[model samples]
Target chain A: MENKYHFACQLIREAGQFIKGRMTSDLDIEEKSGFGDLVTNMDRETQDFLIAGIKARYPDDAILAEENGVTHDIKDGRVWVLDPIDGTVNFIVLQDDFCIMMAYLEDGVGQFGLIYQVMADKLYSGGGQFAVVCNKEPLPVYQERQLAQSLFACNSRMYAQNTGGVRQLLDQCLGIRMYGGAGISMSKVLSGQLLGYFSRIQVWDYMAAKIMGEGLGYCLLTLDGQEPDFKTRQQVMFIPKAKLTEVLSYLKGVTI
Target chain B: MENKYHFACQLIREAGQFIKGRMTSDLDIEEKSGFGDLVTNMDRETQDFLIAGIKARYPDDAILAEENGVTHDIKDGRVWVLDPIDGTVNFIVLQDDFCIMMAYLEDGVGQFGLIYQVMADKLYSGGGQFAVVCNKEPLPVYQERQLAQSLFACNSRMYAQNTGGVRQLLDQCLGIRMYGGAGISMSKVLSGQLLGYFSRIQVWDYMAAKIMGEGLGYCLLTLDGQEPDFKTRQQVMFIPKAKLTEVLSYLKGVTI
Candidate 1:
């Protein structure tokens, strides 16, 4: 586990460096599903680099990555979920606020996680036996803040649709913020920069941050009341455990 | 003018440094107008420090600032508009994504501007005879992009109200972002990281970025078509010249 954790961190840093170097250059950007759902050449290249590094070390580990999807089923042994670049739109447009995320789950439990904010050069890594650290500093323990006293992040779609009383929830919270990426947004929550995040996210998006955040007393919930698995996308709330009931009451009618 | 520009830059950096140092310390946070609109002791201290510096260097200049409001009416020989800490909420909570902004106007015409992103250590300075420079590097000239090609920043209130067909406008654009502060959001637009910003803004909030942005061929407009003065809070759009007519079409019925 120790060796794997160190290897994951190293590979992520190298991938981050590679992505950082390409930011100023021309990107071969392509639309994945729609206009705003952007994918760039750097995304593919970075994912291949991380997957190659992982395969070389742990040949039998199943890899599920954003660009290429999963290599195999998550039945047993080790499964690595990767989002080579978490905020692809931000990467293509701003060259900032995006992250490289990877989570290592063994047989079904999360064992290790990493989210590297490339431009800022901040690496949030931990889980398994290690505590989450931002670069060299241990992330400060966050207080459990109430729903009304803290800022919340709700993606524009949720806010626009007023999904599950999102508009009402925003009115109750201190304010709303939109970061455009699950990795960076959840990172903000884990670091106590934000009170919590409410958005629809995939397994790759929430897995790494969930592991690190839960270790620090944060909570992750699927709004639909189904147990999260490595398969489906769901409306999830990553928040302080104390604010769970309060936030959920507002998001009651929200589904998917 | 050169001396004042250099002086403003020096004073802003000093204030930024002072504010940055105090971020990790205890903050006396208070709500100003509503729950989310916050003010802090640091905001007051930083404002006082900047005002004192300006008085020492340019004693006759009229100073209009956020914390203390205007020193006097703007029938000016020279006026300095200052926002000691532009994103007070962000400063109190996230401790990032806030800026110290100042714009120097001579006889009501923009003469100099400065916005220091304290945590990032980025100083965007220019105006009068100087072109905008980001930490000694001249900002790259941005091409005018169509509304469909850009991301926009809309305050939560505006988006929720669908004010001026904001919902329809958001649909046509690539995406919507909410940055909480006028300074950081406008800075993103001025730097090409965002397409434009639309929100109700006071004089000090838009003065600095407005000066710097206008010099770069960007345009500022009041959604109500009113000529902006230093006395009123108005709905404004800071965007590329090419996007004006197109964006205005969607916002036809919107009035602030």
Candidate 2:
């Protein structure tokens, strides 16, 4: 267990505690450039909190954030991609369904990724050879599953777009779910509650979960069946290794 | 408050406590007659628990339940509609998102309804002249809203079915969401987190919320633009009174 992993876990727990404490109050929320793309004072403060902590200890680490954009460098050095509150809409509007997200990338490799669903008392965390675990318990490995029996976690926008492939995929699966945050959906995929999750997601959205999921034999791939370039957001999916082909077939050739 | 409403709340709280205590263990779940319809031993026991309580107190009350069929004559008497576990799929397969549901109808009128989202400490409860409240706080009412500003809670099956009106509705709303359980969706609608919810649901599914929503100036109507018959399960929707016609235009004449 490296110190970085310990720091990642502790830092997220602290951030989560801060979020839980203040989220009950009336929050100041505003929409970002896109409709339904939301931001809030808590999100900004949480980002500042994480950045301040990282800068205090590992001052040279590069940062890529949803609210503040990129900082430092990514020419093969340590970088932390952070989205202080990943499900801001759920946070601002709904009673639940939000997460605090952060990922540690070393030399362009995802080392530690953490998604702390603040209210659930479970931190879905993984990095390096580390296995993803909820709270202190290692994630359970479910029985080998078929595509038809699995749930798909997706954003409403994708389903609402009325795309040909998405419409077909919605009909074929056990169900489609949207909990309003990438980290929340990824937690379901890692824990075997969902067979796969697809979304037009950004870098900070799937960074840590991608690192955590790999150890459980899960994969995050683009809809076009290419390995994802973390530098840019794309129509991406995370599916179990056993069911990749079946899930991919639903997304192939059909633009998301 | 009516004594029946108090009884409904207390009974549901106790049942919810029992469910929360036991839900984490491996469950014994089996499929019902319909595809994706599930029932667990907990469902049966909870049904028995509610029926026993009601029978002991109001012996002649007719009961309509998910696990057990109708009991006692229902020509014109008090009826208790109960779905011991309304979100059984979520209960048997996931970490959270299941509820204990019950509605008390007298002479074909919904008098009391309760939806207890067990793990989340939320009991969206009320009936008769009682107002709906979540965890003892009254639900908030928003100003007049339009389609573009509201989230529509819907099932993927509806979107997947590729019906003309549902597809168009899916594309038109500000966003769409499917939380996988009818109880969960109805809870969102009652609390104003969603503008509306559409589903092909059964009697016990939205009955309690329908009772509660009515007091809040909300209406639960069949897709065909008729007042719902409490006796039959239909393609139904719960929409705020202010947004009824707008949402109705999307559902009427749609194949879904």
Candidate 3:
């Protein structure tokens, strides 16, 4: 397990360096679903590199990568969920604010997670066996803040749709931030910079950060305050346990 | 004029260093208007330091600082506008994503502008007499991008309110970013990373970036597609000239 974790970290670091180097070159960009849903040549390249590294080390691991869909049932064996470039738009436009994220799960239960902010070069990693860490430093203890005292993040889709009382939640929090990358935004919540993050995201988007955050005494739940189903794309509120009730009260009559 | 611009730059750098040094210590935070609107002791201290330096060097110039507000009207002889600490919420919570901004004007005409991103140590400065620069390097030329290819920013208030067809504008753009600091967000636009930024902000908030951006061939206008009044807090769009018509078309039937 330790070897797998270290290998994942090293692979992510190399991928980060690769992305940084390619930023100066023209990115071959394509719209995956529609406008704003972007995929770059680098995303595919990075995913392949990471998957190949994992295959070389742990040949039996089931992989669920962003660029490529799942090959095996995630609940049956060791699975690695990967988002090669979490903020593809940001990566294309600003050449920063993106991250490489991966999570290791055994029998569908999360065991380890890693989120590497590419430009900042900060790697946040942790699991049930060990405490969360950012680079060489252990992350600070999780300090739960009231909704009004906390800065929060939500996806623009949610904010635009006013989904699940997101606007009310915005008014309740200290302020709002939208970084366009789940890894970057969720990492901020994991590091205690943001009180909570609410977004309807995919398995690869939230899996690593969810594990890393839960290790820090945080909880990720649906807008209805239930455990989020890991198998489907869904809305999840990643927040401290103490603030759940208050946050849910505002999210009671969700618009979407 | 050159001496005054250099002096402002020097003073802002000192303030940045001071703020960075004091970040690890207690901030002595106070909410000025309500929950999200914050003002720290450092804001007052930084403002005083900047105002004092301006008075010592250019005593006859009228000064308008965020904390102290306006004393003499800004339309008079050479006026200095200062937001000692922009993005106070970010400064308090994240210890980053904030800047020190100032603009020099003569009889209501912008002369020079400076925005110092404290933590990043990035000082963006320029105006009519010079090209925009970040530290030692001149900024890249601004390119005209279609609304579909551009990332845009708007204040959370406008977003939540869906003001000026804000929600429609969100759908048309590539993505949305809310950094909670006009200086930080606008600087991104000034550097051509973002297509434009929309906000209902005050003079100190947009004045410096407006000058710096205009120097780069960008224009700042009201949501109704007119020049923003310098005397009042209002909805303003800071974007390039080629994008003006298309952006205003989406914002035609603004809710607010």
Candidate 4:
């Protein structure tokens, strides 16, 4: 647990550079279960690189990653969650929504979070007393703005399922955005490009992002008004405090 | 009709730069008709800039733009259809997907197409024997690719209304992408990132994109298999030849 925050930051930067180096070259993308799910060769390579780095430095720590799944149990006291590349579709298409993500947890409690914009070389990292930093400059968690004034990042699949939620959210927000990557979408919220983001995403997708968001005083929670379990996937919404109150009240009236 | 292609390209670039310069500052965005429709101050400014530039160069030509509507007759031998900022939502939020689009119609037949990605400084322009060019480099029109190997772009709104069409299309394609902007989505087809893009978009949103897409050998038509009319908005779909054949056949079987 010692220096976990610093360790996460270093690991994220290294992983990001690994991804950046492989961007322009050909990628071997394969279908995972369905067409919507994809895994690239770079995903495997970066996961291996990140896991190896973490295991070598913290031999007793647990690890979780998109490719290989969880390697150990949380009882080990320290655990790392990783999404080597969040937007494989964007990467395959050579678009800009892709990102690298990492998070560290101590006894099941998130201790640090990091999400890096590989192309932009911008890293968002924070936990506890440390403020969220984008490329080393601290960024304040955006204060809750009016929904009509806030930009939102969402996934189409999730938005489709939560039509009522989506409509309600959009009715209040300035606009809706679909970038196709949860990590990148969450980073927008952290960086003020979006006031909030809601998606039906896995733990690995939101682990690192939630850590950074919480550190910046943003709210990341299940839409059902419960704490997100790190072991399972859920429909979650992350919003600034001002929107949180309004959104929560609105969601309460509508039974999902 | 004199130098119409060259004039369209020049006007698009100039309008693109004007929009790019305005992107640095905050935009004044307002709802147009519904929650999904949007407009901005830059949209108006870019339109004004385009109209002025076109009028100075070709006073007798007709003009059609998003904000100003039809400024002259369509029978003026040559007509210019302009979308000052094609992805105004993207422009207002991400400041990226927006583009300056212009298409020239000579006697109601598409003669030239130009779509400038302002932020990326990339332009797709072509007419007649001139090959599609991206930043002056000739871009290969989409190769004859099968649906199983090609990526497709369609918005959630369109997907909802045309579920059968979308499901059939998705069943045949490698994947579906929701980029949230018709112009930006269509650019992918011209650039080879997407094999095609199908969506219910306005004439202003697709006119210039459709012209550029045609130059790239991508077929732009209504979803029910008809030619798109310049006078009205339509549910359009642009597809590479092989996939277009496959999808059109599939659409024929599905009851819309």
Candidate 5:
């Protein structure tokens, strides 16, 4: 077992259990600019926990987070992009299906990442030549399944607009699903439960999953068929090799 | 507590646990018709389990099921509609988020229903003047939320065709979500986690949920502005009273 993967499983398991315990108490929730965008005490506490742990073990590490801003320079030794609670709104409202996510980068390249579905107690970790695994079960490399043979997970932003491309893709897929969070949806694709995922998300949302998915030999492209620049929040699609072309054709001319 | 509600929780919980145990084994998967139409041994085994239990306990009562078809006349004294595995594709593929659903009708009147999310071990049950409870926590009466304030869950069939009303509503709402199963999506609304649900679903899918939502003061209406005719699988929207008018206005011309 790689030290990073071992450390991730233990750290995320503790964070998930701790956050779930806090959910039973009265939650202190506040909106982050948007009305539906939620952040809570648990989110901050969990974020701080991860940051403190990384800083203690790797003092030179860089940290970029959703709740709190960046800690160190990406040009520095190791950088970790973390979304302590990816589905903060889901966390505040449903208390289930939300996630704790992290991506560890070596210098500049994506190396290790974890997307943990807390309520379900399933942690997906991989990258840097490591095979992805859910719990302890090693996930085989994702095989290319046709676009018509699988379900697609998407964010609400796509539906709120009902883009023609999105509508076309939804029509062609076997079915559709949304968990209101990038972590669970991405995990769906990573574990082969879903064929692909389309969403407009931030670096903190997709970086970890992207790293792991790339390690599995999948295509991580923007809806416009460009590699994700990771500079600004952009529309991204993590798809299996077989479905990439078909999904991209549908996504053309749409500002995903 | 009504005998039916008590019975449903006990029956469905047992079924859920039994089916989950079987999921670890090698599943016998066969196609019902198309690729997305899945039927696993667990689905059949669980459905038969529920049917046999019903026959043993209430031999005279009618039963309607997804796999085995109607066991008795709809005009019989009491009819129980059951979908042993609500999300069969999810069950066979992802092995998570599938549900066990049942609705009991007495002389053609919706009386009590159970929509149990098996993987999550949370059951939503109500009707017969009982408050809905998930596990031991009683779900509060669903307060009306605006269409602009919360999310809506819908089926891809509506989006595939881009029914003018459906697209307009999706574009206008806070966001849109799809759980791919009516039982799970409706559970989201019943628990106040989602604002509404729109889907073209079968009797086995919506009967129990419709009964519980109606009991909680939700508006259950077809897009064509008529009462849901159980005889036909029709497009139905179960929404809060606050969002009903706006949603209905969008559905005026569409044949749901």
Candidate 6:
């Protein structure tokens, strides 16, 4: 593995363990924009710890994190995107779906990705050139499953509002699951428990998963079939390539 | 507590802990009747455990459960309605929203209820003369929050249908939360986390929560404003009394 990629994995594992250790303790959880949006003091503290360690070891690398925003220069052609605690709500509620995620971009291309499911102690990580690994074992790109045999992760409101798309997708799939946490939903896809997932998500939500999905030979694309821009928020869908054509074709027919 | 009610609580607590212990372990998950329906070995096993224990202790009691159908004879004086694993999908996926739910009906009237959030280790139980309790502490009916300031739990598909009184109810709430599990969603209402919850649900799904909500000074009513039948399925809404009046007025104006 590349040295920087290895370093990123090690940092993510450490951060994940740190969060897990505090999962059941009293957390300083505060409402953010709304009841649905929450932030914990632990989130900020973890971000600070990771950022400081990364900056000290790699002074020239660019960093983008949930807290402290972006720092360092981008001209170095390598950037680290981090979400210290991806499912803050789950963490606050003492639920176990929360995760720590990291993605490394080199020369404007996603080179490596890591997602650590804290409570389950499962780490999914890979570089584009290397096979995806789960708990140190290689995880192959999932084989194609028919929509009637596959499970899709989705959010309730979005799925309901876009009924035409959802119905079509549901008709083709074995079932639709709404688990309430984006990181864990995507992790299900990565772990082969889910065949695909579609959602209107923020950039931070997609960063790590997109890289991991692509590295594992799954197709991660914008719903509109455009190249996904890492810097801007977008609606994205990740599916195995064989299922992609069918899903996109079905979605195209929907009014939304 | 009545002797029967006390026994019910003990059984629910034990079953809840049993389910929690198995949350992350391998489960024999399988589809039940259709796409949206799922069944697990744990679901059947839990149901059997509850049914056998109930029968052994109260030999003459009529029993109803998700897996075993109905058993014994309805003596018109006492009946036990049970959903051993209320959110099978949540349980199958190891999501934390699943619960062990039970309701007792005396002369076809709900007399006792229990909804145990196994992962959180919180049990919401009550009915008839007893006040609702969370972890054994009585919870007062929330009287301060208005509809505009409270969260509401709802089924996503029902929200999309915009029918059966949900359209009017949706306009009166601060926001809607779709957690995908009826037992888990109603537990939130009993705990004051949600001001109310309305969905097209079966009797098995609402019996336990309905009993608990009523004991907590919340209103559990049908959309059409009729008494729920323990022997039949119905669409129900469980809401705090103050909000119920506001929601009823809103629904009347919609003319549905």
Q: Best candidate per TM-score, number? A: 1
Model 6: residue A228 alpha-carbon error in angstroms: 0.7
Model 4 residue runs over 4 Å out of place are A1-13, A23-31, A55-61, A74-76, A93-96, A137-140, A149-151, A163-175, A250-256, B1-11, B24-30, B72-76, B144-150, B171-175, B253-256
* Candidate 4 residue lDDT tens string, B19-115: 7666678877788887757888888998889889888988987887788555544445678888888877667666666788887777777777778
Q: Give me the chain B TM-score of candidate 6.
A: 0.89
lDDT tens digits, residues B88-172, model 5? 8777666777899998888887778899999888899887677766776787677756566577788766765665478777666
TM-score of each: 0.96, 0.91, 0.96, 0.87, 0.87, 0.78
Tell me which residue pairs clash in candidate 3: A164-A254, B164-B254
lDDT of candidate 1 at residue A235, scale 0 to 100: 74
Candidate 1 local lDDT, A1-256, one digit each (tens): 8888999999999999888777788889888878678888899999998989989989978888888655555557789989999988888778799999999988878897899999889899896678988996788666766667679898889888887677776788878999888888989987888988888778889889888987787777776434566577777788877776777777677562
Candidates' C-alpha lDDT: 0.83, 0.78, 0.85, 0.75, 0.79, 0.74
Task: Give the winner by lDDT: 4 or 5.
Answer: 5
lDDT of 1 at B184: 86
lDDT of 1: 0.83
lDDT of 6 at B34: 74
> Candidate 3: which stretches are off by over 4 Å?
A253-255, B253-255
TM-score of chain A of each: 0.94, 0.92, 0.96, 0.91, 0.93, 0.91
**Runs with alpha carbons beyond 4 Å of true place in candidate 5:** A1-8, A24-45, A71-76, A159-170, A242-256, B1-5, B24-42, B71-76, B160-164, B241-243, B246-256
Top-lDDT structure, candidate number: 3
Please give the DockQ score of every candidate, comma-separated. Answer: 0.78, 0.54, 0.79, 0.32, 0.48, 0.17
RMSD of each: 1.7, 2.8, 1.7, 3.3, 3.3, 4.8
Who wins the DockQ comparison?
3
* Candidate 4 whole-model C-alpha lDDT, 0 to 1: 0.75
